[model samples]
Target: MADTPPPAMPTLADLQHWTWLLGRAQQMMIEQGFDAMRARDPVLPAIPGLTDPETLARTRDFWTDSLTLWQRLLIPQAEPVVETPAQARDKRFKDPRWRENPLFDWIRQSYFLFSDQMLAQVEAVQGVDDKQREQMRFAARGFLDAVSPSNFPATNPEVLEKTLETGGQNLLKGLQNMLADLAKGQLTHTDSTAFEVGRNLAMTPGKVVHRTDLYELIQYAPATENVLATPLVIFPPWINRFYILDLTPEKSFIRWAVEQGITVFLVSWRSADASMKDVVWDDYIAAQIEAIELIRAGLDVPAVHTIGYCVAGTTLAATLAILAARGEADTVKSATFFTAQVDFKNAGELLHFVADDQLALLKTLTTDGFLDGRYMASVFNQLRGRDLIWNYVTNNYLLGKDYAPFDLLHWNGDTTNLPATWHLRYLLDLYRDNLLVEPGALSALGVPIDLGRVETPAYIQAGREDHIAPPESVWVMTRHFKGETRFVLAGSGHIAGVVNPPSAGKYQYWRNADSVSSLAEFIAGAVETKGSWWPDWIAWLRDHGAETVAATGPRQPGEGSLPVLDDAPGRYVRAR
Candidate 1:
């Protein structure tokens, strides 16, 4: 009756991210001004006896280089700056206006030159620390991205076309969409409820056999009459719902595994909310262990084929490594990780923002105990701003079109909160410190965690084009493990690479036929496979897991001391 009391305004935590970003841009402007003040044209001193040929030569060289750079940047038919692999993939730059036109090309090239020259100017600062320089560079890039021609109406031919066709109606709709999303405190591009989770995405057949405060255990129904004696348990990243691995019956890796005669049990994490503010890193590990123990107690299984995806894979490695250190090595029969990295030496540019300054600013807001999920999304979208942020800007606003209903994007849009304490730990220990990979350098649950001490055979799968977990970063983990590691390089980006099903008959993968002496060498000599790597993983599991017996009545899901908690895709998943 009271219009729901005019829904409460978002808190300071929700508002701090924009403040931090704007502050970064402001910092960049101040540094630019300082750099400009310090910069001076090459000054030539008068020589007494003889002409100073060296100084003259230095000035001459600078003039020559500057002229060449300017000529190439300004000439319509001038040479173009080469694009990076990711940049070459952007369709917006492929437009004739951007590439073929002289003026547009010059504008684009001049922007690149300006960005590079500014960064060089920052480096030329005598008293600045490397951290400060890095921040300045990051901020400059963000500013350049914000002012990209594609982001505005006058320069974007597509926007002009739409405006002309619709007589400005499209702009009106887009403005309304923007306002609605702003009110909801979301950066959403589509109606999230366009497709229900259980009905369209996480539709795999399963039941919630057990749950703890941190996670829900879903045991899938066995599809084959004779299932492997060893069960397959997955630890998916708590950053998102577990349905990523079980999107639909046809595309689901879990469903595929079940049909292959393997008992699949998944660890579905609870969506972190205000109530979960007190949840800490140790609390999460204990909760997962408790759920696994409940399953073991109920089914009386001796060993499990443990798998981890993304951050969950990182946590799984740490948790299992700790248990193995405590002399429980036999608990896990084998280990498999998908795009998960423990050694962060070569982890992607996401770490660029994990420095003390940035984290300190972020922690100010996290005192409430959980980073707002929307805020996290805003920060991460910057890493691939063109695709994740601006692509939607063009489609949702300029064209006045709703984002197409995609399972992966849908799940991505349905983001959930991250427990602040756990998130901070992950960022520092794994991303910044690189302690997890160092033998004896890190300890968990009071036990030393050394992946080198882990002899459990591991299967590592990496996305060849993964921006988050570069394949090299994931491949480097092989050196840490003492056991034989089979590494597969799948084609595609992070999410699409892992979710690839064999039926799709798209995207090729490569296998290092020989041992891993070096990632580059292995890549050069790697044998290409035509289809999905799912079959390769399943075969490896079958060979490495405990001996299989005719699955007569292996415990179905929802058995054990606890009654069935609920059906698959439980309440925790639908929380958002």
Candidate 2:
């Protein structure tokens, strides 16, 4: 596979080149759409004779409703569905200047009408798959969203109000924010001061005991006097920092586990740079094994309970399969998969972007040996433009507001560059081909990776509304594990579903004691439990952790062979 080598780093020239290429592709697609529309019948069907009573009655009712609507509009009444759930939350529109103003309301209604007509036209396009059609619809919506009257200073009343209040200082700050982001390749969104790693967030108090070119292992200091006989080590996706599991003392799952009388260790993958372009999937696999060994040797335990979240879990599942085939599966006593998908058959709408043309473009762009983190983030932002993108546009440019202090959003904005070789391998072997879930169809580290060979029992949790890794895809992971498996249908989405603490008592979890099956049957047989699924997970942990020992806290950093490199949230995690 020939690759387009990215320059040492993205230069202005490189950015402009790729931007133009993308624009060209967009233009071609637009031309194809216009031609398709022009080819369609522009003539209307013959009108029904008014002699028909049903047609005459419908015409009369339409005139009556029009008169009623006219009277209501005169009274300044807004239709209930005029503003969708998503649009209703826009504070600028909430102002009387937008709603009470009849002209603005009329414009809003007209815009919605145009949007509906364009979407209908996109749907009527023939000889296309759902994925292709969805892309067209998404593009149409994006164009409409970009031109929203609220996004402009002249049309947005809120921006005018802010200008009046601050004497244009708000606009100046907004320009500052925009320039700062542009300098960073336009990846930033959240306010950097909102939360600092190892200060207010990711401060669960752990030490980096092992460091490698690919990853670092952090051994968290135990909170309880007596800890579980076996240690619990976590593997988080390298796409972002692992601090999400240790965000805050209140919401940190790692903290909760330590407090539950269990020793905890976290695997933190290093943020790569241009120099690390040669890194590959095998490197990450080796890193996982190295982490397990370091934790096992440091804690003086023969085996450890393992948990993998998102893509990290997918790696773990494959790792376990290889280990089981090698008769070394004892390294992991039990397993847990959180919002992870091993199968891509139903990975969700994101798959639409993986088609041939898109993949070809991605390949060209990533030939630089590493895919830029900002580039990846931009693509993901398009998947949920309203929440991930347009919302920020409104707040940053329209409202001229600094990013609100949000830990989750902050972490989301902090993305990592991925090695090209490894990323392409993943996209092809897993997402595109879906070879991971198939028995005897894939291999890793020269060993055949058959998920059915994995005898390690697992507990899997799926979010109710996860679009990236759909719940159905997560549930499909249970089919390969040979041991007992418990599937939990948790309320909420990918991140919130996994991070929900019982203390908050917000979302509920549904548990089905039966074996692995379709998501529908599982939900039908499941029993709903209010609060987080952490307790049930803890119970399962206790069951796996049969023998207890007198609570000697976790091994200190630099204990024995694995030396403590630095304090928790090491330099790798703190990297940009």
User: In candidate 2, what are the lDDT values of residues 1-576, reduced to their tens digit?
Assistant: 999787598654565456556655665664555445546844433233332334444434443333333433444543433457766665436677776666566555555556655575576556788767877877897787777777777677777888899998888877777787788876457778879888899988878887777888888887766678988889999887898898778999989988888778888987767677788766777677777887787778899999999989999898898888889999889999999988998898677677778778878877677887887788778776767776677678656786778888888888888887788778888888999878878877888888888888799999998877899999988786787787888999988999998899998999887764588998888899999999999998788876877555345445456677899888898887
| Residue 23 alpha-carbon offset, candidate 2, angstroms | 36
The number of the candidate with the highest TM-score is: 2
TM-score of each: 0.82, 0.83
Q: Residue pairs in steric clash, candidate 2?
A: 4-367, 5-368, 6-368, 226-551, 558-564
For all candidates in order, the CA lDDT equals: 0.76, 0.77
lDDT accuracy of residue 178 in candidate 1: 79
Candidate 2: residue 461 Cα off by (Å): 1.4
Q: Compared with the true structure, what per-residue lDDT tens digits does model 1 show for residues 1-576?
A: 556567688654444444445555665665455445446523544352222444334434433444444455444344545666755565656676666665466555555555555555555555577666766767776776777777787777667778999999989988987788789777775567776778888887888877667788888877777788888888888888788888766788888888889888888888787678777666756665665666666667866788889888887777777777878777788889999998897787777878888899879877777887787777767877767788777778777887676777777777878988778878898799999988888776677778877888899999999988999899987888888789999999788899999999979899977875889988999999987999999999988864665644435665455468799877789886
Clashing pairs in 1: none
